[model samples]
Target chain A: MSALLAVDGISKSFRGLKAASAVSFELDAGAILGLIGPNGAGKTTVFNMIAGVFPPDEGRVRMDGRDITGKRPDQICRAGIGRTFQIVKPFGGLTVRENVIVGALASCKTVADAEREADRVLDLLGLADKARQPAHALTLPDRKCLEVARALATRPKLLLLDEVMAGLRPTETDRMVAIFRQLNRESGLTILLIEHVMRAVMALAQRIVVLNTGEVIATGTPEEIAADQKVRDCYLGEEAA
Target chain B: MAMGRATRMLIGLMVALLLAPFIGNDYLVSVLILCLFNAYLAQAWNIMMGFAGQLSLGHALYVGLGAYAGGALFFHYGTPPWIGMIVGAAIAALVGGVIGFLGFRFGVKGVYFALLTIAFAEFTRILFDHFTWVGGSSGLYLPVVRADHDNLLLLRGRPAMFYYVILGLSAAVFLICHRILGSRLGYYWRAIREDQDAAQALGIDTFKAKMAAVMLSAALTAVGGVFYAFYTNTLYAESAFAMHRSIELILGAIIGGMGTLFGPILGAFLLTLLGELLTRLAENFGHGFEGVKQIGYGLILLVIIALRREGVWPRLAKRLGLDGEKAS
Candidate 1:
């Protein structure tokens, strides 16, 4: 089957700085694809483009064989593409349940339906106990979980995670990696994760794409990409590989 | 999800609405009427400032424009004040739409957005001040009516009519805001408020959402303005769009616990009564009261912010309720 999502020749620039240039990749159903890059290498920019934060200056993004480049973010989300932010943003005034309620409402046809779905997600995320807590009060890892939970509440087919594992401890990261693997295995949710954490990416990603200075430098299975000389030169030092 | 405290609060509001007339004296009734007007204005302001996170420092512009458009039509064309009120509200909505388009399109935010709104209000005030057709700088006034004539057609005859009209409006506004705040539209507004770029990434049309809120809020606030114009039968550019009015509306919401349905009503009632008491004290103490009311307002605001930053009622309400409670 055709790749579930195709990022075709996308390019984005900000104030003359090339954040992403002619970058292209594809993700299949139930796949975990890792996107890694140095700081300011436009990893988040590419993620932003895919999530419809801003349209690419060039090229198209396709999902399920349908072109969705430059579409509104909410429309892209409703089209089954959900994403977590690099810096988790939550509604401070809303309870944990209510924060997910925002996502549920965003995905649902009615308030009553969304509220029901939100309740289910609250329980499923192991956040049922904290359902009534405000989003701002949670510790870093819980807030990260809240971000994923909020996105998952949208019932997306494709979940984009941006640095979700960044601040998590090793144990928490391992647990989240397991959860991510489980999500892909059981839910059949395609995931495209951007991370600098090698262990988490290696634990979860089936395929990894490496980028440097706004261009794709390597793409292959995690092991193959790790062994590539150019990938080492760009991301890992020779020793890291 | 269960039958919790927010629902009870809503029920309490309903009960209070039904019983207010019986329990309140004439002066208290007048005070309540003012509270109702403030409540409506505060709610409308909440839609823009509270939900959308667009701080407006001159929302009083809508009220002034609304009062003028409706009041002017009644005085100049022999039209009923009720019809004129609609005209006023439309004008205010139109103005709001224009500003929203400009502000959102240009990505104006925080203090800049506030300054822009203040400038707009000032500009409108100057325009009205120069326009003699609406009585100019001398101010506009409707003819005094015969006592107890109860002229339903004029919408000008009775305090009870005005009171009921304002009450119904305040209730309607509350329910409408509550419904919208819980709906998908509310999510969009909150997303935009909390994180505009994030919301856009989720495919929300942030510009359109903000614009819609601005118009709706402006129109509804103008509705209150229409009531103000007819209830008191006078209008002036300076007083209608005063900076103090905008501050009062926002202060009421903030003090009451912004983002909640009942906060505005509570804030309005408290402030209006407090002001009334202060004024009475000033009167009893004799002339040249100076700036005691301003000092009182300043003191009360500081106390509230120090005691409860999010709001007085919100923290208290949260202990027993879900709607206004701080998350986690």
Candidate 2:
């Protein structure tokens, strides 16, 4: 079977500086793959290209063997890919349910159907009680969960998470990991996540891709990645050595 | 059936308005008609600014275009006013579509978008000023057909008849606004209003949604323009497309509680009544200044901004225990 998502030799440059250089990766259906890298490693740039924020300067992005490079963001989303921003964006003036409803409207035909999907997503994210509160009133962690809930309401086949565990406490991070695990195992949801939090990445990811300075430095199972000399020399630090 | 407080209150308000002309003096009826006319205009403007988060400071362009288009057809061609209204609305929608396509497609937004609208309105006014076919700068005057004064079909009518027409129009527009706000497009608009980039990321076609708002608003405003032309029996490019006219169209929505269902209507009534009261008070005190109404409006706007930045309707609704199902 064809891969669920294939990023083939994508490159992006802002002015003279290259943000991503020939980055390539493939994620199979129902797989949980983590993307790890140092700051300025062009992780988010890859996410942007995949989510159709902007087209890459060169190369193709494929979903289920269909070329989706250079499509509009909304079209890409309708093609079954959902994404979250690094900086959480909750529709501040709207209530929590309302924010999710906007995302749900993308997949559902009617407003009533969207509302039902929003409530279901909110319930899964444990935000049912705070559904009536304005999204601006949510705490930082709750806001992060709200972003996830919004994305989930789109009913995407592939979910792209950008630093969703940042600034979260250990327990909060664990809760998120458990939720992702349940989603992956029960629903076979494919996920590609960029995470700076190594503990969460190591706990959640079945395989890891390490990037450095816009290039893929290494890709392997967590144990294999931990044991790689080059990964230790560059990213995992001397402790991994 | 268990009716909500707001539903009951709205029914009461509509019934009172329908009975107003029967009990009130002609002078009072005229003022109410004026208030309802503004209410309709404000509601049309609200769809663009409030729901879609697109500020149009030169909405008078649509009003002027609609007034001229419909009025000219009726006067020269002897066409019925209702048909003229549709023709005018179509012309306004086309103009609005052009502006929307240019602005949104080229990435003009926020205050820049406002300026684009202003420029277009000013440009149109200048063009109309020299277009002698429509009477040019002197103004276009509709015929005073005394025999048709009470004929609703031709839109030549007495003050009482006009009052009922405007009342019906305002209520119909309000219901349309309410329905749109509850639909899928309404959700898209609210999302766009909060954050454009985020809304785009969430799979919303922001450009299409915004364009819909601009055209719909323009078309509705033009319908109001048709009403204005027939009711006043006169249309001047200077007054119809003036910057002050555009600002007047939006003030009611802003003061009423932008982005809410009832805010624009409440704001129109409050502003019109207060302006009239100020005029009377100034005359009674023998201190009637040339800009007394303007000064009163300025003061009222300041007080409202300082105390209730969200606008008057939300607060009033809350006080009346009607905030349970808040409309946005």
Alpha-carbon interface RMSD for all candidates, in angstroms: 2.0, 0.8
Indicate the worst ten consecutive residues by lDDT in candidate 1 chain B.
B319-328
In model 1, what lDDT does residue B14 have? 74
Proportion of the native interface contacts kept in model 2 = 0.75
Across A174-241, the per-residue lDDT of candidate 2 in tens digits comes to: 99999999999999999999999989989988999999999999999999999998888778897863
Query: Which parts of model 1 are misplaced by more than 4 Å?
Result: A14-16, A238-241, B1-25, B318-328
Chain A TM-score for candidate 1 is 0.96
Q: What is each predicted model's overall lDDT from 0 to 1?
A: 0.84, 0.92
Model 2 misplaced stretches (Cα beyond 4 Å):
B1-3, B147-149, B285-288, B326-328
- Please give the RMSD to the true structure for each candidate, in Å: 2.8, 1.4
lDDT of 2 by residue, B1-328 (tens): 1237778889999999999999999899989988999999999999999999999999999999989998899889988878988999999999999999999999999999999999999999999999998999999999877743598888887899889889988988999999999899999999999988888878999999999999999999999999999989899999989898898878888999999989999999999999889888888878647678888888989998999999999888778887767473
TM-score of 1: 0.92
**Given candidate 1, what's the lDDT at residue B74?**
80
